[model samples]
Target: MPKPKIELHVHLEGTVRPALLADIAVGNGMAPPAPSPGRFADLHDFIVTWNATTGCLRTPTDYRIALLAYAEEAAGHGAVHIEPIVDAEPRLGLDGWADVLAACVDAAAEARERYGVSVGLTPQVFRGQDVGYAEEAARIAVRFAGRGVVGFGLSGAEGRHPTLPYARAVALARDGGLPFVPHAGEAAGPEAVREVLAMGAARIRHGVRAVDDPDLVTELVERGIVLDVCPTSNLRLRVADPGRPHPLTLLHHAGVRCSVSTDDPALFDITLSDEYAVAAGLGVDAASAYAAGLAGMLGTDTDRARLVRIGRAAFGGIDVGPAS
Candidate 1:
């Protein structure tokens, strides 16, 4: 839709197509989730569905298939670069974690060569999990540093496990020269956003609630910490209604560095293009959407020339200032 945009905050496991998950489950001796999984009542319910889908990913082949499927989907949406969060610990046992990461890198390399789309892997630690697990993820990330691994992230429930819990892991990742990104302000409020900021987060995933704290918003804008905001996920999670009460517009107005993304497109039945379409329908002008996308590209280490080309082609030009 936007000529191969960059997707910054998507989870590779959660983006598994339902049909593929069923197929993988059958192939891998696992049971897929129930037919409809009873309509998700909220974000927690959605996570339940997500874990079930992730059950399909029990082997390296499954990881490869998931990566390839997501790459193909991103390509179909005209996404040139995709940054998918990877959790080697869950899918690949600690002893074989390096092999797991290597498999993902190889799969992404294959996708780039065969499909003409680039995918960068960012290993993630599920917060609310043992802090030791995060440290282990960081260690493994450091081991694979500079080898197709671009950044590190923290996912899972942020409200229960405070951002400071992973402070040491973030520091380790940053020390190893990886960009630090953590989930914050999605289910939690603006306070979570502040905690992530204190932890030296380079980019925040789903920081929509940062609008609730003007001082923090100002600091974010000043420091250039990009928020990868997924609008459809916000609405589906009941964090915000898409139309009247979404704080994304307010965050942009407050000079927050924000970007649009599809958090879990398959789970939510949406895509990067769908995300852009929803934003447009919800009153975010084409230019603002373009800037948001630019902020995302700017926040990452993607190809600058390609980003500039897409930015100009998408909106004729990019102002890259606060949305007014």
Candidate 2:
């Protein structure tokens, strides 16, 4: 078996199996969205697909099924730990958030027993929505912290939606002792990455764009902020040129912490193992990848320590430094 890995940038909605989604949509008396060729034309097209797929999941049971399926698939890819972003937007309603979160927690517990993969939920505030909605999402996240949810995140179109307005929500997450992890530097640029840092982000999803500004890269290194980089997602979204080397290599060489992940694995048609393969292709050794993953995980210290031991044993007793 390959070394045990950790995935920190996955999305539950984005991991729904298309066949299951179609079945659920028909069962709900709703028309299923048309299937695409897997690769999207652009970020907007991808978001449209994402929204349509998530629309099929209307009940708490739907979320439970999706979470379990994601867990099984992630575990198959050798993921020992996964922190997936769960979006409970207008579809589930504010009051329904608790049920869905509880369902996820239950499903995750079952998945741990069945698949040996620890799951953590990170409820996201859609940045494209109004700031009030973000605040409400943060409150719900705070309410569920330590029960099932491990952190708070902001997702959506980063190009048009500035992360500054979500400051109140970020503050609330910080006050609740939840890690602040927001998407940045993918659809947007270095400035967007800077904004999330200002909001006290411990990790930045798809922060590969931070390589554009040397100063910001230095700041990320100095602060020990992890960039959860998804190579295939960047290639599929056209955020990075396929012909060029990925920014993960640049950031890692610059002493910025980075972890490989399969962002929207089902949507991007990739896997955690494939992501590790890509990292290896970029000259990242297994020990270094293990180190980055350990640093990037948002799980409890005990969980982190256990994974380190697993990785060390799996990879021939390689030293992985600290658990972070």
Candidate 3:
């Protein structure tokens, strides 16, 4: 039986295994930066590393290899489904983005055939990108809807860059029939989460700070938006309250649907399994934590039920309650 896992808030560049990144970078004449001991420092540090890796991914084969490697690692972590957020505007190039996206889809399908794990793409727009860039990505997503692109996401740095600026792109995605999973409350406060809510994000990535605002927590619970929580990633970035003060428990108690994930396993040196263990330590029971993960991220009811069955089989007679 497959180990039950689903990761909804992963970035392909962030997930690149360090060793592979080194090899790929050297091969491309862009030597990877020296290995760092910490997962991440400030957001600026992360962005710098992000640019360095992005520079290495300059070809179709490079994109395919990066994606396939991520799929392999995700499957190893028991991930039945992995949605890699692709910030296509910068990396894939506007003119050749479609071909790059097609290559990614092919990689995903191949991973499923070989590893028994499924993968999907989420065309991600950087929060700092202007409205036109967001609109362009959204238009492309609309053009290729259902051709391996499962959802639309807003990734990258979140701050004073208002999510509302991307409203048109998000609306285009919704009109063209795609789900919105925007990153919020990761670096900012609950007000940032509220902003995404107003912009109609179906899921909130790293919404740990919602606990800081009881009203916002109530709003999230009432609306049933899944908080794509990344405990290790948050700790590594120092975005969340330290240790016990982390909002995983508070969000769970508040009735917000929340899922555990490794936002960037390579950087954090963790995996979905490690993430689950962290959540367990944070007060969620083993079985309930697993169930919360499945419920919070699975794209369909059928998939969610399949995960529940897998959980039951793996844990044996332990009931993993509904994510809701």
> Can you write out model 2's per-residue Cα lDDT over 110-190, one digit (the tens) per residue?
998999988878888877777887788788888878876789999889877667788898889879978898899998889
Give the winner by lDDT.
2
lDDT of residue 179 for candidate 2: 88
Relative to the true structure, candidate 1 has a C-alpha RMSD (angstroms) of: 3.2
* Worst window of 10 by summed lDDT in candidate 2: 315-324
For model 3, what is the alpha-carbon lDDT of residue 272?
Answer: 77
- Which residue pairs in model 3 clash with each other? none
lDDT tens digits, residue span 47-124, model 3 = 776676556666667778988888887787777777788776555667667677777888888888887666767877
TM-score of 2: 0.95
Q: How many clashes in each structure?
A: 1, 0, 0
Where does candidate 1 clash, by residue pair? 4-78
Tens-digit lDDT track for model 1 on 1-324? Answer: 445466788988878877988998889777776643423677777777777677677777788888998998888887777788887555566756667787888898899888777777888887776788678878888876666787888877767656677788888988997878778888788888888777777788898888877888888888877788887788878788645667777777777756777887777777788887776665665567556555654223445455656666666746644332
On TM-score, the candidate that comes out on top is 2
Candidate 1: minimum summed lDDT over ten consecutive residues — where?
Answer: 296-305
Query: For each candidate, what is the lDDT?
Result: 0.75, 0.83, 0.75
Indicate the residue-level lDDT of 277 in model 1.
Answer: 78
For candidate 1, the per-residue lDDT at 42 reads 75
Off by over 4 Å in 1: 35-39, 285-287, 298-302, 320-324
